[model samples]
Target: MKNYLFLFLCLLTQNLFSQENVDKKALKKEYFTTAEIDVKPEFPGGGEKMYSFIAKNYKIPESKEKIIGKIYIVFIVETDGSILDVKITKDIGHGTGEEAIRVIKMFPKWKPGEKNGEKVRVQYQIPISIN
Candidate 1:
């Protein structure tokens, strides 16, 4: 009986410690829109650099049907400067949206938004053209 009790206690302790560790890695619950923030998030280099990066990375998808228009993407910039929840708000078809998403996923960390002197996640939108 003592042996079983000791094993149960050890298991409980291990489970509690594991849960704590998981909680530590969980994302914070602070999110704000760009308009709601005092300072909007920025790419690591700035607008010009961000545009350059995008131009360099973005590939124009090829389609015999001639897919032309803009692909609008929305993503959250976390307080830790990481991007999350990338989604396509508008798509031009012909894999342009997926290509835009792929390039966005390759983007480096951002500067993170600030609101009330605290780092916060902010929603950002970008339009990619496929002409």
Candidate 2:
């Protein structure tokens, strides 16, 4: 009986502090993090796995020119092994922005970040270089 009472109080306290509004950038900082391409992995599909996935699935909107350039895309890998809040921090100005977003959205859910072993939201970034 005493244990149940303590548990209830703990739950109530946690509920009160849990913020409903989530800041994506701040959340990213809280999760286990790394930035910049550690090693230029010639990963299958241009080294940007997500981009590759996008290319594999998303048909580049038939609105781009024939100029090949690097498209810099920044996106969140998401805690549930999914991609979210994707955007082109820099655009090459040939419909690549739209294409980058399309590829990110197609990714499946990912392992959510953990804070002290608890599942938490995360923000991740990836850069796509289209040659």
Candidate 2 residue lDDT tens string, 1-131: 99999999999887766653344445555433433323221223443664557567755445446656666665555445565678788777667788777767766666455555555545555666655
Best by lDDT: 1
Q: Could you tally the backbone clashes for each prediction?
A: 0, 7
Model 2 — which ten-residue stretch has the worst lDDT? 34-43
lDDT tens digits by residue: candidate 1, 34-83: 99999999998898888788889988887789777888999999888898
Badly placed stretches (over 4 Å) of model 2 are: 1-51, 58-65
What TM-score goes with each of the models?
0.75, 0.53
What's the lDDT for all of these models? 0.88, 0.59
